[model samples]
Target: MSELDALRERVVALERENDELRTPKRRRIRGRSVIGAVLLVLAVVLAPVAAMGTWARLQLVETESFVATFAPLASDPDVQDFVAEQVSAAIDEQVDVSAVVGEVFDGIRSLGLPPRADTALTLLEGPAADGAISLIDGVVHDVVRSEQFADIWTQSLRFTHDRATAILQNAPGTAVQLSDDGAVTIELGVVIERVKQAMSERGIGLADVIPEIDRSIPIAQADSLALVRTVYQVADIGGFWLPWLVVALVVAGVLLMRDRPRAVLWSSAAIALVFLLLSAGLGIGRGVFLRAVSPEIMSAAAATALFEQLTSLLAGTIAAIALIGVLAAMWAWLAGSSRAAAGFRGLVDSGFSAVRGAAERRGLTTGAFGRGIDRFRGPIFIAAVVVVTVLLIASRPVSFGSVIGAGVGLLVVAVLVELLRRPSEPKEMDVDPSADAATSTAQDPVSAPDAVS
Candidate 1:
């Protein structure tokens, strides 16, 4: 068993033993442990969810993360496509390419080449329409994908988030305006004007036809404020402390159990359940949010995108926590006293020992340094495993490449650490057969002193 696992098992046993000694079973309140376990279950269930909510709020409410959060959307194909459609529709209103086509047809008909010329021109309308829409699509694409668009996107997000935060605090903000009916809005007038100017600069010739485009999209409505207020209150009071409290409660609950490893497994299972619950809650909350707002207030795509972006990191974190719990439980199970667990451990030890033997035979394991490696092998191995797991989980987003890389790196470290262990030399027998026989004769003389012998 690992030092940590052993220590925990001992602690759990000692704590329970101490409690029992202090109070007789008959004198103790009925079902006290059951009630305590129930509370612990609740803690395991709620803590992770509360932590995820806190993260979502921090990301949404903070200025830097808020801007960074939506910056990538400017580059998203769908988002760019949406922007292009809206801009193209607004610009198409003023350009009237069909009018230009009509004028050309009138001029061509005046040539008097054929009576069916107008009908022929009408046949060209589909191609002309395609060409016009395609041209608008190209111009909009370039504008939306530009660095200028990125800056605008960042600024707009910051303004909107700031406005939302202000409204939450009842403070002043310009970009975030509210209707008399309490519909929240972030005006996109500047963004539309910029796109028009960009299209003109790109020599699309439709700049003159691009009418003034200014618009406001609703982000939230008045009725959702009650829900917002609840979250705001959590951010105000719980903040980062909620996660810590969760840890304390979970630890206390685990210690109350006489089998800490089993408790760990149970807690982990409960945490997974919480993850499922939180995911369901997010879906339900999205519906609630939508129902509370006017459908015309915002684009469905935009609303979904906002909710997704806000929850992405939180979801990833929850997944990581669940993964950690599963790994921890598995590790604890490996240390069980069951026959299968023992066999598995023995196999692992034998594999390690074989590797060590090969290294020693190759002269890689020798001297005081090798001895030092043997002394701290367990701790060093644990530290390396922890470092690798944490780096994969916390430092960067995990990908296939990253997982393979981390696995290879950990294997190399383990091999290198094992290579530094000095193999033990077999001890010679303390007494030869001849010496034992001589010692027996001496013992006969000594036995005479003990009369009964």
Candidate 2:
């Protein structure tokens, strides 16, 4: 047999002999315990949610501008076409760009203008104006639904369109269209038609028309600084609770897996605290960046600005968290899996070992990427204590009871995690049956008498 095959065979024989040393039934029981352990984990995860009924609303409860904010994302034609089979499930009232196409036709008819466009306004805006078709629809809805002036506004809408078109036609540099390369075209028709179409379908009417008409409101003014700030604040507030819920859920999952009840309860609480600090740091960083960058612009209405900022920040945060956690977990796995390490070394000819040695020399090596470092544990513990002390000194500015409960709960969890973490199993002996046979022969030095017989 090849050397590799012989080595594998020897390893298997040793393992089987080792198995014989322990009762087979004990291993079988351990295998069964793993399945029971999984179910236990799921139960622990759901427990916190059950206890906090209303408090749990912090997790999935829609944000204040949820519909307005997300409406644009939901109405992408690409997304619509992709889900065409399920399009029937979408309510008709859902204002996709398709829905607004009819409105644009109506607006053209009202203006007594040709339906032909000099150039596509949407094309001019390109991807920048995506999902904003719904924002136009929203303004239309607001104008169309106004209880006091809806009728008057609807009657004047056509006249208002003509006037707005005229105003744009007269404005310098604003009337020229852009080329496919995003260059400005000399043709006024291209620019005018684009603005007319977006406005007409949007149902701008009296309420929304005046602001866009103010020539002083430059294109740059649309940046919406205040909105970014408000979004950051609202997100920060919601963020405070979000981490706690996530932590509780994760702890429950881990404990259920380990089948350690006491550990699960305590660990869940500790996880929540870590989540809080992480969330806060994220929120503060986001809020500061959005606010300090631009203070001059209105950024649209205050709430809209905030919602957009929050959405952008949240997207970035989620992606970062997912990527970093996966990489860290992979590093930890590589550090722990020596068998896998051996296989890797075989293929790479000790390249990884050399790199590790270099890293160790430079003080860049960690015992294991995630194992030894109390990253979440130490930072969270210190932060929690500081937050509590600050809150207490401020005459209980916040709910001390909740904070204390959460902190204590997390401490208990950290302790439980340390306790439940399984130690490395003792390595099996690399025994060969041949070796045993040879040893037996040597012990019976008087085997010469048996040979003579």
Candidate 3:
């Protein structure tokens, strides 16, 4: 009984030791999971911020990109009409055609006209003012719609890019000014000058009396200029580095996970969701912007055109990122050990096998070349994916079309590789009868002795 008790105690001690040994490992695994979860969440949360930052950086830091983005707004009919209306209003306000017409009538009356003639001339004042306003409106519309105006628009944007950057940075700017009310105004004084020139060329004497007008037209407005500035500053500061940081976080998080493929799938899906929300948020923001901008400041159509044009690049970037995330998630799922993934892979393999077999039946075998490719098939496919990924990343201003094109190209390459690969022939096994009999004798010693007898 004493010996049995001692034995039982020994067994208990061993069990306790085993539990102690596993406890630390379990704790470490839990800690890693927690850390990885935190990192993945941070990455998903920062993806939209990184995207916006990249856009802000590109628009503010690269003058050429900024010009390219907004230069086309010049040709938009709504924009042209807006400019025409604003310039015509400015000219009418400054020139005072009614007052000018009245003065002309008064001058004629002062030239010794009879009472009846003076009364008739006074009656013509209203018609004269209306005709002069109509003439100014027509000339302004013509100038705003002309090709010369588009050239001037592009040049003005290029020249004002720096000042625009400064304004967004919360610094003083003259050519492009941000008002206290969050109105972004660009000096249309240049457009006014063009109008004056056009009117003069049309042989209108009143154009000489149109004094140089300095007017600024509101292009965009925000709810709070300070908020806009703050956002701009943050985006500019993080633009170049934030995207890379998000990538690093996501990679680190995936590596730390025990189920790396599942982690990649979840993380990429989360990223896609975030970007989709961002795209939706942009759509919602357009509505809010149109509502907030009063008609007195800018017409709805004009504001809508401006908002869409300015955000087109940002929209494209968001779409591209979301698409990449979706692709990555699909890749992760396909590479996983799940039943669906396995079934899909099997289907693809069988299809490829059938194609290869049909080709071989037609004497299209690649012989040794096909076998060699089969040996390196996995690495070749991985290289193709890597090349497409690199090209997608290196392409400036990545768009949906480019991403889809690269994906299609990769699929084609993968299909070609699969078709080109040929399995090597199996080697025949050499049978050794004596060796097999010796092994059987070792397994059945009794049977071996009976055979010897």
Candidate that scores best on lDDT: 3
**Least accurate stretch of 10 residues (summed lDDT) in model 2?**
213-222
Model 1 segments more than 4 A misplaced: 1-40, 85-142, 145-147, 166-186, 199-214, 220-230, 236-239, 276-310, 357-453
TM-score to native of every candidate shown? 0.61, 0.25, 0.80
* lDDT (Cα atoms) of all candidates against the true structure: 0.65, 0.39, 0.82
Model 1 weakest 10-residue run by lDDT: 444-453
Q: For residues 31-134, could you state the per-residue lDDT of candidate 2 as single tens digits? A: 54465445444444433332232221221233323323333422333322222212211212233444355455456456654445523433434342344554
lDDT of 3 by residue, 116-194 (tens): 8878888888999899989989999999999999998888777666666677765653555756666656678999888
Better of 1 and 2 by lDDT: 1
The better-scoring model by TM-score among 1 and 2 is: 1
lDDT of 1 by residue, 324-362 (tens): 555556655776666888899899778988887776687
Candidate 2 C-alpha error for residue 188, in Å: 32
RMSD of 2: 22.4
How many clashes in each candidate? 0, 11, 0
| Predicted model with the maximum TM-score | 3
